[model samples]
Target: MLVVGGITRLTQSGLSIVEWAPLMGVVPPVGEAQWQEAFDAYKRYPEYQQLRPTMTLAEYRFIYYWEYAHRLLARAIGVVFLVPFLAFLARGYLRGPLLRRLLLLFGLGALQGLMGWLMVASGLVDRPSVAHERLAAHLLLAFTIFAVCLWTAADLWPTPAPDEGARRRLRRLHAGLVTFGALLVLQVTYGAFVAGLDAGRAFNTWPLMAGGWWPPAAWRLDPPLRNLLDNIATVQWIHRTVPLLLLLVAALLVAGAWRPAARAGGPHRAWSVALLAGVLVQATLGILTLVTFVPLWLAALHQAVALLLFGVWLAWLHVATRARLAV
Candidate 1:
């Protein structure tokens, strides 16, 4: 859904379907008349008027399908989750904290769906694009949902038996990882800002923007802080800088986790290595995407890798924080 949502935003397909019909929208325009009607309705919006005034019915459908598939997938995920959930609840397989966890997930899923429509609605009024902040919200909420699921599953899994190594304090590594995860979330939010504003297109050069790092951001918005959100150069710079910081922090964590993970008594060694590797891969893809002017495939891959990196971080956290969890 994230990747498709990225594509939907990239192709400017988000506003293709003006209306938010949960059940009735399940079936898309089938016949010619239906297609024309859908297109006509889309024509009423600013995206069509300001961006693609001369778009054909066929062209409209192309963009329409991306958003449709994104929404369809969201619905499918909800149904997939709900059916098993209900069955489990009825069978008494889900209860207590587990039930509460699932219930919370369902509520978040529903809220995410609402956020999606709210994002779409942002672009329909006078502007041809969604608000960058809202786009970031939707993306971050999706990430949060995935993270919650991971954390919940970790809670359900049996904790490992503590060994003599558990005596060794891991407070530093845990703290470092927590910091990295927070930075990752901030980076992702700025990434959405970058995509929303097409910030990557400018500042084609990395390490330096338009020439030097001093400017960081080119234009200063009304309020000083607004530039962080509204300024393209600042957004790209932050996105660029965060990864370097993450890489540095990741390197430190890798170093810290190395011996512990290696020795039998240490934390699981694989997670730290996997996380570092994910960061490297994601960083490489990000550089490539920036240098190449954010090609569709590369950008899409970058988006996928970002999520992958986040997932890895989540998994590592589950392991790193297990001692605390056990308590």
Candidate 2:
């Protein structure tokens, strides 16, 4: 689902629906008349009028189906999750804190649907695309919900016991992971700006922006600070550099987890190893996505890997923090 959602954003397929009829929208056009009505509504949007003026009915259909399918899949996932969840609750599978957490997860999932539509609505009015800020908010919310679900699920299962001294060190590791995870989110948010501004198309080259170590032109925008948010070059630079910082942090975490004093073993070692592997894969995917100028497949893969990496870090922190508190 994350992969498809990322593709929809990367391909500018979002906002193709032009309406948010959650229940009604679930059923796609059944006849030619209904399909034309949907297409006509899309024609009225700024994306069609200004940005995609050359788009044919066939091409329009392509994008519409992608977005529609994405929405439908989300609805399906909700049903798949809620049905089993209710059954489990009825059978008393969830207890105390776990039940409360599952309910919270359900609420978050519902809110994410609303947030997705809010993002789509941003582009239907005056803009040719969704606002980057809103896009980031939508993606971040989805990723957050996903991470929470994974963490909650992990908590419900058994994990290896933490040794006494290892607990203190694990607490420190947990804090670092939380900080790193937050930074990863900020980086992803900046990536939304990069996408919104079509920044990736500009650089098209690694290690530099437009053959310069630093695009001096990026800094010359209005009020200077605006460059950080709006300038394509600046946004791309930040996106590239932030991951390097995350890679460094991930390496440090791996080393810390392996230290003799830490007594880290079992789940601790597994999480540390997973963290290191995920970060490495994510960083490599980021570079490949950039070098390839953000092709649809690679871009989607990059986004999926990022969410998975975030999940790993979230799980690591959740377990480590609980062990620390128990000490």
Candidate 3:
């Protein structure tokens, strides 16, 4: 669903549907007259008039189906999740903390649907593009739901009490992983910001932006603070820079955890090592995505690897603190 979203945005199909109709949305316009009606409705929106004024009906269908499929996939996810969830509850299979967590996921999923519509609606108004901040929020919410689901899935397995030596080993990684996790979240949010603002399309060079370290153009917006969110150069520059900082944190984590983990022959250092590698690969993908002018596949790969990197962090953090989490 998330990757499909990347395709939708890349195809400029996000606002093609123009309306949020969860129930009626399932059955897309089928007949020739119905299809023309749907196209007519879309033509009334700013996206059609301003961006694709010459879009033929066949061309309209191309973009419309991407958004249609994205929304359909969302509905499918809800049904797939809720049906089994309720069934398990009725069968007395889910209870206590597990049930509460599942309910939380369902709630977040509902909120994500609303956020998706809000994002699309942003583009339908006076502007032809969605507000980047709202797009970031919507993407971040999806990431949040994914992270929580991953945590819960991991917790379904046993987390036994560690011996004192093992506990001490875990202590070595706890602070580092927590700090890395926080940094990862910030880095990913900036990534979403870049994508939403289409910042990666510019400054198609590595190591510098527009031939400068900070891309002097980054400071163009007034009040410096406003530039943080509204300025494409600033947003992309932050996106490019955060990974370097993340690499530094990951390095420190390995340096701190290596000795104890090797002595104990445990998994702590392995995760730290993997974290570093994941960050490196993701950083490389970001650079390539930019240098290549944000190709769809590369950009989508960047986004997917980001979730995978977060999965690494979640797994490491869970392993580090599972005893406490189990409680």
Candidate 4:
């Protein structure tokens, strides 16, 4: 469902549906008449009149299906999750704090649906695309749900015990991982801003932007501070810089978690390695997506890897927290 969302955004297909029919929309257009109806409705939007006035019904269907599939997939996921969750709750499988947390997760999922529509609606009015801030909010909310789900699972499962001799080192590693997670969230937020602004297409060159180490236009926006969030050049610069910072912090985390005497190993050590691997893949994918001008497949891969990276870091934090509690 998330990948479908990414594809929808990349194809600029998000506003095709224009309406939010939660239950009724599960059924697609049945015939030419219905398809024409759907297409005509889309034609009334700014996306069609301003951006894609020349789009044919055939071409419209291409984008329509992407948005349709994204919505349908989301509904399917809701059903898949709700059924099991209700069953588990009825059986008294979840207790007190866990029950409350699950309720919170469910609420966040529901809120995410509304936010999705809000994001799509942004493009339906005044502009051909969603607001960058709303886009960031929508993307961040999705990841937030994903992270919470991982967190809840980690809390339920059993993990290896913390090594007594290495607890000090593990604590340092844990702190670093916490910091890393915060930075990762900020980086991902900035990335959404970049996507919303079409910033990746601005300067395709690496190691520099527009033939300079620091692109002049990055800070050229009025009021100075708005450039950090609203300027394409600055948004991309932050996107590039954050990963480098994460890589450095990850190295420090790995170093802090290493213990020669423990020999038995620890969760921090294992998770640190996994976290580093995810960071490397994300960095490479980001560069490839940027240099290639954000091709559909590469952009989709980058989006998928980012969520995966966030999951890995959440897992690492879970284990590290458990180890600290054990100590």
Candidate 5:
């Protein structure tokens, strides 16, 4: 479901449906008449009228289905999670703090749905695309819910002991991972800005924004802070460089885990290795995404891999903290 949502964002399909009918929209258009109605609604938006004037009914259908499926999957996940959860509660599967946590997770998921709609709503207005900031908020909220689910699931299982000294070190490592993750998320946000502004179409070159390392007239653009947010060159530059910082932090984390004295072997070692590998793959994908001009598949794959990597690091942090507590 996360993968599909990421794909919808990458393909700019979030606004294709033109409505947020959580119940009725769960079912896709069944016939040509319904499809045209959906297409007509989309055409009423500025995105179709101003930017996609040449779009055909077929192309509209393509994007419409992508978004519809994305929303439908969200609804399905809710049912799948809630039905069993209620049954479990009835059967006394939930108790104590765990039950409280479960309820919180459900609340977070609900909030995520609202956030998704808020994100799509931004695009349906005067702009042809969603606000990059709102997009980032939506992505972060979804990932946060996923992370919480994974964390809670891990809690259901036994955890390793925490060494006192190792606990302290792991705390630092966890903090670093979180900081890097936040930066990576901001980078992704800038990627959204780039997409919203169609900046990718302008600067297809790699290793530089254009013929220069920076936009030729970057400083001449908007106000200093606003420029960083809206300037294509600035946004792209940050997006490109932030990942390098993440790679460096990830390497340091792996080294910290593998050091002989740290004895970060066992689960911690395995997680460290996985973290390193995920970051490396993500970096490679980022580069390819740039050089290839952000193809839908590669871009979607890149976003998915990033979320996976974030989950890995998050799990690693959990285990590291537990190992600390045991010691």
Candidate 6:
């Protein structure tokens, strides 16, 4: 879904759908009349008027199908989740906290859909693009759903037993991981901000921006704090800087988790290492995406890697928590 979203955004197809019809939207335009109706409706939006005024019916369908498929996939995910969920509930498959967890996940999924619509609506008004903040929210919420699913899945597996002392260490390790996860979420959110502002296109040079290590205009946005989130240079700088911080934290996390005392009793040593590797891969992809001018393929890969990294982090947290609780 996110890959398609990246494509939609890159192709400038997101605003092609002028309305949010979750139920009826399941079936796209089936005939020329319907297609024309859809296109005519889209023509009412500012994007078509200002940005793609010359778009023909075929051109409109080109963009429309991407957004349509994106929406359809979202709806399918909901159904995919709901039917099994109800069946599992009826069969007592989801019991105790697991049921609550699934419900919470479902709610988040629902919110994600709403956020997508909110994002799409952003560009329907005066602007030809979605509000960067809303886009970030949409992207973050999608990851949140993915993280919740991973955490839930991790719960279904057995955890290694840890002695009391190791449990204490694991607790600390879990705390660190949780903190690291929070930071990752913030980093990704800011990354969305970068994508939203198209900040990646601003600094074509790696290890530096526009020939300087620190671009002069990075902090030029009024209200220094706003610059951190809104300014393209500042956003890109922060996006570039966060990976280094994450790497440091990841190294610390792995080192602490592998301490003789902690290592004696945690889940297999692989989870932490896998997480560190994911971080490295995602960071590398992000840099490549930036230096390469945010090409569609790299941008899509970057987004995919971000999701992968989030999953790894969630897995790490799950394993750590499970290890801490194991007798």
lDDT of 5 by residue, 197-267 (tens): 66766677778776777777666665678878777777777777887888888788778777787676677
For model 2, give the RMSD to the true fold. 2.0
Q: After superposition, how far is residue 125 of candidate 2 from its true place, in Å?
A: 1.1
Per-residue C-alpha lDDT of model 2 across residues 200-239, encoded as one tens digit per residue: 7777777877788887687878899998888887888899
Question: Model 1 scores what on Cα lDDT?
Answer: 0.87
Q: Residue 271 in candidate 5 has what lDDT?
A: 81
Candidate 4 — what's its lDDT? Answer: 0.87
Model 6 lowest lDDT segment of ten? 261-270
Model 3 Cα shift for residue 48 (angstroms): 1.7
TM-score of each: 0.95, 0.92, 0.95, 0.95, 0.91, 0.93
**Candidate 4: segments with Cα more than 4 A from true spot:** 165-167, 259-266
Q: What range of 10 consecutive residues in model 4 has the weakest lDDT sum? A: 259-268
Give the C-alpha miss distance for residue 188 in model 4, angstroms: 0.7
Between prediction 2 and prediction 3, which has the larger TM-score? 3
The superposed Cα distance between candidate 2 and the true structure at residue 73, in angstroms, equals: 0.8
Per-residue accuracy of model 4 over 9-51 as CA lDDT, tens digit each: 8998999998999999999998999999999998888889999
Backbone clashes under 3 angstroms, per model: 0, 0, 0, 0, 6, 0
Clashing pairs for model 5 are: 161-323, 162-323, 162-324, 162-326, 162-327, 163-323
| Winner on TM-score (5 vs 6) | 6
Give stretches of model 5 more than 4 Å off: 163-165, 168-172
In candidate 6, position 318 carries an lDDT of 72
* lDDT to native, each model: 0.87, 0.83, 0.86, 0.87, 0.80, 0.83
TM-score winner between candidates 1 and 6: 1
